[model samples]
Target: MFTGLSAFPLTPMNEQGVNEHEFIRLVECLAEAEVDSIGVLGSTGNYAYLSSEERARVAKLSVENAGNVPVVVGIGALRTRDVLANAENAQQAGAGGVLLAPVSYQKLTDDEVFSLYETVCRSLSVPLCVYDNPGTTHFHFSDELHGRIAQLPQVASIKIPPVQNDLAAAKARVAGLRALLPSDVTIGISGDPAAATGLLAGCDAWYSVIGGLYPEIALALTRAAQAGDTEQAIARSAALEPLWALYQEYGGSLRVAATIAELTGNVSQPCLPQPLRTLQGEARKRVEAVIDMLSLS
Candidate 1:
């Protein structure tokens, strides 16, 4: 379930809360594309903003609509007790795995973070993926800390941040992590811009944002790299430079993704939760221009 491409779709919202019809459509789209797994309630799904009830519903909706695709639900929360609840909900919703980030308001010590995983792992029936998304969670996982956490019984994968762009450096970094993790535990790379290099460098999987929207192209890159077709994978990634630039210019993938979703009519305009607005005016124009130039759906 951990290997290959795991597409993380946006949890489109309306004033009434999660737009179940649209969210299901997104999940069905991914399943039809035959992605390795569907990641629901992820950072891209705005897990942090949704209430536990909303999250439980989203998890259920994703798994129910995803056909045979394995569903990995994000169970991150500010409190360990809440994380446990989310984990239980995901398990009940039949998630194949759960992704947990050490979400925190105050700075957490290594021991505190370790304890959080320990407590959650004890209660989990499903496998857990360590979500080391420092950009959102604000808690960084040192390599040493990662080694320690990977030893936990249910730890199946570690979703690391982007690798260095240089292939050799990326390979070395992935090699170092490989030594720390058990052979059964895989390393999945996030950061869409660097995915091709990371995959070519030996990371086992791509925990992809772009894959959620453009599964065919992302899968082409994944398959090319997995087949050791370096030139093809690099060229494919290079073709999407304009899209990656939009992510950088917009501060992150969330706004740009929501913008694309809106532009494509996959979801209603103003799809994001309160206070998290989509790109406006010129920023929106640039995103549209890039989408057209790239012929992105």
Candidate 2:
């Protein structure tokens, strides 16, 4: 049920490992700012890197700290049964809804992918938002496949990552998909920079990572978009351009969370694990310089 600005909090970790205090503090700060909602244990939260026990702890603390705010858990995995199990856990933990990404890797046929989602749809009690992030998932759900899954009663929203870089093409794709689906189904646009673009195009909401680190700014831009104030939205989004630039420098999606931890001073060690590459030396200095330059808070 999240619409405007939903901040996806970074799951704080220390040198010794899990940093519950840091996580709590960040959540508290975001809550105080009154973001539209909080998405716990999403891609930004590094759910894939966490153990089952760690997931439970993070999910529980995230829910507890969120209080009355709507919190959606990202229940995603490489297999079917595990995704369903995670969904059940999220429901038990009192999440408002779930953002379910299709199984990453293993390129499946349309029928196979539809069947996987069908199982999750039938099992989860809360509403489901299908997350379309083909960049990492390997399998991009075609319009026909999306239509097939859209028939499920639990399907509440579609979080499209704007698969095609061309804004016009993206709009066409989203429009075509929307035309096939029911009118009430919400379409949430991912890719933060294009949030305003997506809003102008007819998506119901914007799923954001940058919003986690800068709730007020994100909210301001989201509000402007909702109000159809293009000039205001552009100005607000532009203010965070430097932060977005830093994200691009670091490589993949993990940089989004890592940058948030760096700017906010929440996580003890924001570096990614071995082989994944960590920011140090010149790289670390450049990242820190950008942070100092932006004075992002």
TM-score, every prediction: 0.99, 0.91
The residue pairs in collision within model 2 are none
Model 1: runs farther than 4 Å from truth? none
lDDT of 2 by residue, 180-283 (tens): 88777888888777777777666778788867776887778888988988778767767767766666666654665575466456666654443444466777
Maximum-lDDT candidate: 1
Q: Model 2: which ten-residue window has the lowest total lDDT?
A: 269-278
For model 2, the superposed segments whose C-alpha errors exceed 4 Å read 14-16, 163-170, 270-278
Q: Candidate 2 local accuracy as lDDT?
A: 0.76
Residue pairs clashing, model 1: none
**Backbone clash numbers for all candidates listed:** 0, 0
* Among all candidates shown, the one with the greatest TM-score: 1
Task: Give lDDT tens digits, candidate 1, residues 159-270.
Answer: 9999989999999999998998889999999999999999999999999998889899899999999999999999999999999999898898999999999998999888
